[model samples]
Target: MTGLFADDSEQIDRRTSRWIRDAVGERLQQCLRPESRLPTHLEQLMSELKKRDPEDDSH
Candidate 1:
């Protein structure tokens, strides 16, 4: 059914997002030296992510 498919698709998308965010965050932590600016960078990234429209699809 369409409903079932949609539900699964949404779940997959959420999991994928979590995986990507976690992977990027882990790598950022490992590669970003000057620990002082890490928080600022992370805050900016999160703020931008929150501002972006999920349905826009225009990167």
Candidate 2:
């Protein structure tokens, strides 16, 4: 018989990913204070990156 969760590994992977992300983010933010600056070629690089990548609202 087919199980209720055809793929339990997927759920476990997602939960693990979220936990790792949250833990890393909290520690990194605490270690690094606010430091913001952009490169001179940022605009050109950004255009290229956008063309080559799909954006995600993670940060």
Candidate 3:
């Protein structure tokens, strides 16, 4: 039989993901503005990501 904790963990995971997705959408909407600044923001993000791992091309 499955334990009660399994269902609770699954529910928690779903809730956490939904919250994160919504938060990201809201934050991105606020950050991505003026239309022209999109490229610069993207480049900055990419540069930061590359610094973490030089071979990370999946970004």
Highest-scoring model, lDDT: 1
Candidate 1 per-residue lDDT, tens place, 1-59, comes to: 35556655345565577567668868877887854456777789866864653643433
TM-score of each: 0.45, 0.37, 0.36
Clashing pairs in 2: none
Q: Which stretches of candidate 3 lie over 4 Å from their true place?
A: 1-12, 34-59
Which consecutive 10 residues in model 1 have the weakest lDDT in total? 50-59
Candidate 3, which ten residues in sequence have the lowest lDDT sum? 49-58
| Candidate 1 global lDDT | 0.64
Superposed on all Cα atoms, the candidates' RMSDs to the truth, in angstroms, are: 10.2, 10.4, 10.1
List ranges where model 1 is wrong by over 4 Å: 1-12, 39-42, 47-59
Q: How many steric clashes between backbone atoms does each model show?
A: 0, 0, 0
| Root mean square deviation (Cα) for candidate 3 | 10.1
Q: How far out, in Å, is residue 31 in model 2?
A: 0.2
Clashing pairs in 1: none
Better of 2 and 3 by TM-score: 2
Q: Which ten residues in a row have the lowest lDDT in candidate 2?
A: 50-59
